[model samples]
Every structure is written in structure tokens, then in C-alpha cells.
Target: MQFLEASREQGIVTVTLSRGKVNALNESVIDEMTACIRDLAVDPAVRAVILTGQGKFFTYGFDIPEFLEYGKEDFLRYLTKFTNFYGALFLYPKPVVAALNGHTMAGGCMIAIACDYRIMVTGKARISLNEINFGSSLFAGSVEIMKMWLGQKNAEIAVYTGALYSAEEALGLGLIHEVAAEEDLVPRARRIAEEFAAKDGAAFGSIKKLLRGPLAERIRERERASLLEFVDIWYSEKTWNLLKEKQIRS
Candidate 1:
């Protein structure tokens, strides 16, 4: 895929985001990722998957500069594509792990939480869903994903406060499963992926479905109706003005 780096070894697939400096998610990036993950889920040779970003960022989140370029119709299409990708990643049958190498913000945080486990790299990097900071709204399914991992209160606080937490803080909040030095991050992730790959594929997938299916279905149902509205708000004058002001300040 143009936006990602995918490699398979010993039944494990590692997919690294490589679109730009920070691996921001856009319509094309989402499409390619969704397709790749769906294929891996069904591939018999693929026992597990690791998702990560290529450089200093796990991902900087959605392509806001691109978002500003979208009109209503275009934004709606983007939102729908993103919603579909989120659903696919959340309910992926094979084991998925996020190797957080650096800063992960907004939509990037959503993708990380969808994985079965998250291993964050230690440093000055942070993770957050700062949508509210820019007057943007979270996708309905994204809210569910956050709640599934952080519980109701922590999820609400994280989204609403638009706070950036250091790796240790994120771990304390249960946003990530483990924290490793930057050099050790990928190896740690690979070790975990191997452990998960050792499980019986069919039974493991089935049990995962049984455990996470309800929430995945809930996200799908909400996105079907709310994505359009999300696009509307994203294109609204209020949000645009807020974005403009933030850009000027920067």
C-alpha cells in the first residue's frame, strides 16, 4: 500500500504507517489500511498483526490540513471511509497490537486503542484524543472504543479535557498495556505478537468475537447514522474559525 509498510515473517505481519512525517490518517490512508487488515484477518499464514508508525510519531492523527480543504460532500465521504476502517480494525479477527513509538493524538489515539494491546515507547512523547481542543467531535464508534479501554469516567475525561499524557501517565490510566524504551518497543511488540500467534487461530478469533462483538456492533450502528452529522460539524463555520485561530496562534 502507498501509505503503509507491510511485511510478514513467521506468521506475523507488521504494518507501519508511512504516509508523511507523522503518518497522519486521510481518506486514502484509511482505505489502504482497512483493506490490508481485512486481508490479513482472513489469511491463513497471518497469525498476528502489529500496527505502528514509521518515524517519530505513532501518528499525529487525522489530516487536519486536508480536512480544511474538504467541502461538505467530500468531508462526508471521508468520514464514512474512516468509520468503515475503524469498524474493520476494531473487530479484526486476528490479534492486533499497537507499537506506539511516539506521539499519538486524536484519530491516532483511536486506532491505537482498537488494537488488542498497546505497547508505548518511553520518552517525551505523549498520547491523547485532543479533538475537543480544536472544537472537533469524535466519531461515535471512537467514543465506544475509548470507553472500552479507559472505562466511562477516564474516557470522558481524556476526550473532553484534550490533555496529553506522558507514557507513564497513560499507563496509569490504563490507556496502554506496557511501556518500553524506544529501542525495545518493536521487539517487545513482536514478542507479544508471537505469544498471541501461538493460540489456536480459529478458537482465538471466535472468542475475541464473542468478547468484543457487542461493542463493535454498537459502534457500527452508531456510525451508520452519525457519520454524516460528524462531517457536517467538521465543516461548520464554528470549527473552521476555531481551526483558523489555532493556526494563527501557532
Candidate 2:
């Protein structure tokens, strides 16, 4: 795929975000990732999945500059797909680990929070759902997933303040499960994935579904309305101006 690199070893699949340096998510990237995850869902040989990115960013979130060129309807469509993609990942039956190699911001943070486990790299990497800082709002589904991981109060703090957290800070906030040195990031994630993969696949899948199914249904019920509000704000005069100034540096 143009925006991803997928490799499999020992019943685990590793999907790396490979779009330039920051691995910015655009329509094509989301589509590819969604397709890859769907395929892995049905593959008996795939017991677990690891998601990560190359270089200095796990991802910089939505490609704001690219989306700026899209009309409102087009942008809304993409937003719907993006929300659905994360919802799918959130409820994915098999264990999925996010080995956040670097910065995970905005939509990228949404993706990380969807995973069964997250291991962010130590040092310079920061993570945040900082859309509010740029005048953008988040989807209800995303907020629901965040609440599942971070509880109601912490989720409120994250969404309201748009604070950037270092790996250690994110750990303290329960935004990430573990922090690993840069060199150990993927290896540590793989070790966790292996442990998860060793469990009986059917039992794990059933338990996961039981645990997450209700919230997933709620996400589906509320996502359309939330996405409409999100798109309205995204294209508003103030947010548009802020987004115009945004740049994705490779």
C-alpha cells in the first residue's frame, strides 16, 4: 500500500504507517489501514496486530492542509470513514497494540486510544487530543473510546485543555499503557502482543466483544450527529484560518 507497510511473523501482523516522515492520515491512508485491519480480522493465522509509524511521528493526525482543499460534503464523508475506522479498531476482536514511535496528536491519539494496549516511546514523543487548541472538535465515538481508556474526568481534561503530554505524563494520565526507550518500543510492543496471542483466539474474541460491544453500538448511534458538528467546526472561519497555517513537515 502507498501509505503503509504490512509484514507478518509468528502469527502477528505489524502494520507501519509509511506516509512521509510524520505519517499524516489522509483519506487514502485511512482506507488502506481499514482494509488491512479487516483482512487481519478474518485471517486465522493472524493472532495479533501491532500498529506503529516510522520516523519521528506515530502520526501528526489528520492532514489538515490536504483536507482544507476538500469541499464540506467531501470532508464530511472522509470524517465519517475516519470515525468508522477507529470504531472498528476499538472493537477489533484480536489484541491490537499501538507502538507509538513518536508524536501522536489529534486524530492520531484517537487511533492509539482505540488499541487494546499502547506503548509509546520515551523522550521527545508527545501525545494529545489537541484539536480544541486549533478550534476543532472531536467526534462522540472518539470521546467514548477515550472515556473507556481514561475515565470520564481524565477524558474531560484531555479534551478540554488540549495539553500535550510527554510519554511519562501520558502514562500518569493513563493515556498510554507503557513507555519504552526508542530502541525498545516495537520490541516491547511485540512481547505484549505475543502474550496476548498465546491466549485462545475464540475465547479472547468473545470476551472482547462482550466487553466492548455495548460502547461500540453507542458509538455507531451517536457518531453521525457528532461528525456533522465536527465538520461544521472544521470548516468554520476560525478553524479554517488555523488549519491554513498548519504544516506537515517531513
Candidate 3:
């Protein structure tokens, strides 16, 4: 794929986002990732998946500059696909772990939180759902997943403050399951994936469905309206100005 690299070892498949240095998500990246995850889901030999990114970013979130050129209809179509992909990942039938190798923000944070487990690299890298900082808003599915991981109070604090959190701070807020040195992030994540892979596949899938199914349903119920609202705010004069100033740095 143009934006992703996938490899397998034993029963674990690792998918790394490699779209430029920042790993920004565009329509193609989203489509490639969705296809990769779906393929792994039905592959009997693939027991678990590890999602990570190359270089200095797990992802810089959506490709804001590219999307800025899109009309509202096109942007809304892309947003719909993005939300659906994350929702599927949230309730994925097999174990999926996020190895946060670097900065994970906005849409990137959404992907990490959807995983069954999140292990972030310590030091320089930071993670946040800082959309509010830029005058943008989030979707219903992402907010639900954030609440599931961070609890109601912490989720409110994270979203409202738009703070960039260091690994230790994120761990304290329950944004990540653990923090590892940069060099050890993937290894730690793989070990966790292995532990999960050892469980009976059917049992794990069934329990995962039971745990997240209701949230997924709620997301489906409310996602369209939220997407419409999100688009309205995004294309508003203030948010559009803020977004135009945003750049994806290497």
C-alpha cells in the first residue's frame, strides 16, 4: 500500500503507518488501513495485530491541509469512512494493540484508543485529542471510546483542555496502558499482543463483542448527526481559518 507497511511474525501481524514523516491520514491511508485490518480479521493464522507508525509520529492526525481543499460533501464522505473504520477497529474481533511510537493526536488518538491496548513511547512524543484547541470538534464514536478509556471526568478534562500529554501524564490519565522507552515500545506491545493471542480466539472475539457492541450501536445511531455538526463547525469561518494555519511537519 502507498501509506502502510504490514509484516507478520508467528501469529502477530504488525501494520505500520508510513505515509511521509508525519503519517498523516488521508482518504487513501484510511482505505488501506481498513483493508489491512479486515484482511487480518478473517485470516485464521493471524492471531493478533499491532498498529504503529514509522518515524516521529504515530500520526499527526488527518491530512488537514489536503482536506481543506475539499468541498463539504467530499469532506463529509471522507469523515464517514473515517468514523466507520475506527468503529470497526474498536470492536475488532481479534486482539489489536497500538504501539504509540511517537506523537498521537486528534485522529491518531482516536485510532490508538480504539485498540484493545495502547503502549506509548516515553519522552519527546506526546498524545492528545486536541481538536478543541484548533476550534474543530470530534465525532460521537471517538468521544465514546475516549470515555471508555479515560472515564467520564478525565475524558472531559482531556477534551476541554486540549493539552498535549507526555507518556507519564497520559498513563496517569488512563490514556495508555503503559509507557515504554522509545526503543522498547514495539517489543512491549508485541508481548502484550502475544499474551492476548494465547487466549481462545472465539472466546476473545465473543467477549469483545459483548463489551463494545452497545457502544458501537450508539455510535451508529448518533454518528451521522454528529458528522453533519462536525462538518458545519469545521467549515465555519473561525475553524477554517485555524485549520488553514495547521501544518504537518516532518
Candidate 4:
């Protein structure tokens, strides 16, 4: 739990991403999160789960500098960890809520959409799926989750434009269920979790499966091919040069 903190109260478990500063998703963080979700999903005492972050960032997204040095195999392995985590979150048999304390972008946005509910704090922070700007392809699992949360048209627009939305704008677009002040974010998420937790787990979990199962299957069916295509494009000379220029400038 080096990168995460888990605490339970009133049958709800809160898992906070505590990575330094930006809370970027790297291999270790993703693996830990996948494990966390799986563990909580089966715990009978846990009625709902609250997923959030520490400090000012929910997450800034993938660790670009770490990804920059990845060879094809390394990158594919990394993508596998990422996509598998998304699938786990999407199919977890318990209610999950995301409390966005700050900026949620790229991979962070993917994680937020996988949750059953999303509550973002109003602030200077923005939310976006900025993969296009990074010259990266979206995983099918992530695309399916985004579409499920935001509808197809909004998902298409968000991915195509890489637009960052304020909390109000995100709510208008259906990216988040509610918005609150920074201090109220987790409290709001916990209250929502309590409301959801009152439902019988078996019934709620079954209905969730019925609603999302097809999309999850589609994502699984396309996983391997999508990963291959993404890795190929990511390692191309043009992308390498683009990343190199960005790195030098940074």
C-alpha cells in the first residue's frame, strides 16, 4: 500500500491514491490499485468503496517520462497492466465512487469513468481525456467506459478535442454526478456511498453486471489487437520525435 491508503468506516472503504504531488499512474500504482479493487470487491463487510486522491491532484494521468523510455514490449506490458486494472474496476461487484479533488486527465479520466459515481470538487482544476494530444491511442476498455459515462457523442468530442472542463462544465457534459467545494469532495462521496451501500449487494451487483457486461466483453474481445496497434503507433519514429521535442522543451 505504498502508493495507496485504505480505511474503513460504517461499512464503506475509502482508498486514496497517495502518490507524490501529481499522483501519476505508473506500473506500481496501477498494480496496487488493481489489487485493491479485487480485494474490496469480495469483502462481505464492505458495502461500498470510495476511490480518491490525496492533496491537490486526483491524478495527472500516466507517467509520461516513464512511458517515453519504454520499448515496445515494455510498453505493451504496461498497457496490459493499465487495461486490466480498468476491467477490474469496471466489473467490480460492489459500488465504487470517485472523488476528484483536483485535475483528472488522460488515464485519470479513464479511472474516474469506471466508477459507479463521480463527484468532483469545484476549483481551478480541470478534467480531460488528453490522449490525442499525447499522440497515443485510447484502449478499448477505456473508450467503452468513457462512452458509458459520457454517451458516444460527448466521448468522441472529448477525445478528439482534448478539452479540459471545469467542474460545472463536466457536470453539464455528464462527466461527473456532482460537484462540491474541495473540503466537501470526500464527504460528499462518502454520503453517496452510504446511500448506495443500503442496497442489497447481490441485487445491486447483478444489475450492474447486466448493464455493463456487454461493454466489458466488447472491451475484452478487442483488447489484444488494440494494445498491439497502440504500441506500434506509440513507438513510431514520428511519435518518438514528438516526445523528444516535448521532453527537451520541458
Candidate 5:
């Protein structure tokens, strides 16, 4: 199956991440996703978008095999990939909703947080930006972007401790907007997006821009730092072992 898929109807375009295995992000998925969002960003028919994933995983973050194989270069490429990958959701002018089916951790959580609205399933699904625990540091701008948007306290605790939060806990902490029973997630997320679509497009766009403006500027300035840091970790033995401990490969 294709790593990324988009189908638009009734003003809603749902972009699905269904890369096999853990739905991990890799080069192919990154390239396709960047192109997909760029295309929709220009399409007038797409008033709102729902970003989701298949199976029991939203994304396990980056594919670990590449990291193990390429060493330092993989890290640089990983950071660069996400800068462009996450750039889409951050820059998309319209409302974007995240319907996280499962395992939204590390990079998965970052993608969800970038959305205008987020809805995740309750139960045992875990979500977090857990790079620190994985022995990987976030791209420099990710610090400020996450701090401002997810709240400074969460940003500090989440990164420092690298803990994953349950859906209920996330709702309380404001990382995600709502939580639903697993099966109701996509429909509920669509409902939320449709409601937002009914609002004044210009007003919504303006407010989002206002909220994201400073952080977006910061991301632009330090986007390359993520690449540099990523490459540095690529050479770390700790990083390699973690990938193996997690039993991940290309």
C-alpha cells in the first residue's frame, strides 16, 4: 500500500499515514507527504483536512533501520525530513485535524500537535514527543514550538522526562483537544473539522497565523539545527542500541 493517501470529498480531505509495520516515517513517506500537502494547500476544494493513520500505529517516529545503517547522516536526514514533513501541517492555511488511531509517540505526537485540532482514542494508546528517552534530541526549534503550543510546563516535563501520556491525561494537559472511544475517533474528528469549516475562513486563518507566527519564525530560523543534531546522534552507540532494543529495522 502507498505510504500516504489523500481523498477529498465534501470539503474534507483526509490524509492517511499507513506505512506498513509500525507506520514509521521514512524517506519515501516523507517525500510523498510533502508533495501531498503542497498539492492540497493549493486546491480550493479542500476546506478542511483530517490526518490519520492505519492499524494500531499513527507513527513510531522515524524508521530506526535507517538510523542504524547511515549513522550520523541518518540523523541529519531525519531532522531535515521532519522539518519539511512537519512544515506542511504548520504552514497549511486551513484547519487540519489529527485523528490518531494509535501509537502516536515521538514524531507521531509532534505531527498531531502541529494540527489545528487533535482527537485521539482513549484506552491504552500512548502519545508523546519522547526523543530524549530515545537518546535523540529534538530539533532546536521544536523546543519553542512545542513549548508555546503544548504549554511550557508540558514542554519541559515531556522532553526532560520523556514520558508518554495516556489519552485522558493528554486531554487534561491540553496536548490533545478531545478523546473518544477508539471506534468513534475518525467520525468525531471529522465532525470537529466540519464545525471549524463553518467558521469564517479568513478569521480562522488570521487567528492561526497570529498564534503560530512567532513560533513559525523560530522554526524557520533553526530548522537546520535539527539536521545537525540529528546527524550527531546518528553516531551515538546509545541511539543504535535503542533501535535494536525496540526491535526496529528498515
Candidate 6:
């Protein structure tokens, strides 16, 4: 399957991340995603966007093997691109929903949080940001998004505990908007989106902005600063070595 795949039906644009098994976030994935999102964002027919993954896992996080071989410039460039992709998601005019297919971890969970809401499928699959376990941390923008979306304490726990939660646990913690049986996941998510899409689009958009208005400027500023800081830190030899270790361990 392609790195990114999409199908438009009615007022919904469903994007499936199908890079490979246990799909990991990489430059190609980010690039394809940015373009897809850009196209969808402007489509008059697209009233909402639903993101999902294939198989028993949503995403496992970054591709450590690729990162380990990256040099200072390589890492920096990668991050600049990544941050820009995230910036697009953060400020998208329309609501975006993540249908958490399965086993989301580290960068995977972070990406899910970028959406306005998330729906998860039931299973033993775990979800979390385990970057700390890998001697890394969330990008500044990621942290801010989590803080704004999940509250300060919940965000802290997700980043610091490095603990993975079951679908039910994620819902209880407010990490996911709802959970459903595997078969019901997509339909249930669609029902939720349909309700939202049926509302006055302008009013819906306004409410979203109203709620986030206070933090919009701050979030945008952090997004820019994060892009620069990410580039600067990616050059660290320690980071390269850590990536190498993660690759070998995986």
C-alpha cells in the first residue's frame, strides 16, 4: 500500500496511513500526509477528515533505523519538515478526527493528539508517548498541543510515565473521545463526525476558534520556535547514538 491513501465519500475524507506493518512516522509519511491534508483542507466537499491506520497497530513511532543513519543536517531537515506537517494539522480550519486503529506509541500517540478528537478500537493494543524511554522527548509543539488538548497533568503523565494504556483506559483518561468494538469502530466514528458535520460549519469552526483563541498565538509561536530548536538539537551526537541503539534493540 502507499504511504498515504485516501477516499472521499459524501462530506467525509478518510485518510489511511498504510506505509507498512506497524507503520512508523518518517519523512516520506510526513511529506505525503502534508500534501494530502493540504488538498483535502480546501476541498469544498470535504466537511471533515478521518485519519486511520491498517492492521493490528496504528503506528509504532519514528523509524529508528533511518534516524540512526542520519547526520546533523539530515536530522535537522527531517524535523523541519515534520514540524511543518504538524503545524498544518494544528491549525486546520476543519475538524480532524483520528480513528486509532491499534497499538499507538510514542510519536504515534502524539500524532493522534494533534487531531480534534480520537476514536479507538478495542483490543490489548497500547497507546502512549514512550519517547522518554528512548532518551528523547516530545517536540515543543507536541507538548503544547497535548497540554492544551488534554490538560497539563494528563499531558505530563502521557509524556513522563512512558506507560501504555488500553483502549478503555485511554477513553477514561480522555486521550480518546470514544472506544468501540473492532467492527463498530469506523461506523461509530462516522456517526460522531456526521453529527458534527451536520451542524453549521461556520458556527462549528467559530466555536473551535473561540475555545482555542486564547492559546492560538502562543501555540503558533511555539510551533515556529520548535521547528528551529528541533533543527538545532538533531545535530547532537548523543541523539544519533541513541537512535542507533533503538534501532538495534528493535
Tens digits of per-residue lDDT, candidate 1, 1-250, equal 7888999999999999997787888888998998898888778899999999988899888777777777888878877887777677787888999999999988899888888999999988999989888888888888888888899999999999999999999999999999999999999999999999999988888998999999887777787667776666766789888877653110
Worst 10 residues of 1 by lDDT: 241-250
- Which RMSD values do the candidates have, in order? 2.0, 1.0, 0.9, 1.9, 1.9, 2.3
Q: In model 5, what is the error at residue 102, expressed in angstroms?
A: 0.6
Give per-residue lDDT, candidate 1, residue 6.
93
The better candidate by lDDT, 5 or 6, is: 5
Which candidate ranks first by lDDT, i.e. highest? 3
Supply the global lDDT for candidate 3: 0.93
Model 4 segments beyond 4 Å from truth?
Answer: 245-250
lDDT of each: 0.87, 0.92, 0.93, 0.88, 0.80, 0.78
Task: Please give the lDDT score for candidate 1.
Answer: 0.87
- Candidate 2 vs candidate 5, lDDT winner: 2
Candidate with maximal TM-score: 3
Scored against the true structure, residue 100 in model 4 reaches a CA lDDT of 94
Residue-by-residue lDDT tens digits, candidate 2, 92-188:
9999999999999999999999999999999989999999988999999889988988899999999999999999999998999999999899999
Q: List runs of model 5 lying over 4 Å from the truth.
A: none
Per-model TM-score on C-alpha atoms: 0.95, 0.98, 0.98, 0.95, 0.92, 0.90
As a whole number from 0 to 100, the lDDT of residue 150 in candidate 5 is 68
TM-score of 4: 0.95
The sequence of per-residue lDDT tens digits that candidate 4 reaches over residues 1-250 is 8999999998999999988788988899998998888888878899999999888789988877887877788878988999888888888899999999999988899998888999999979899988777677888888877888789999999999989999999999999999999888889999999999999999999999999999888989998898998888778788777656654111
Task: Sort the predicted structures by lDDT, highest score first.
Answer: 3, 2, 4, 1, 5, 6
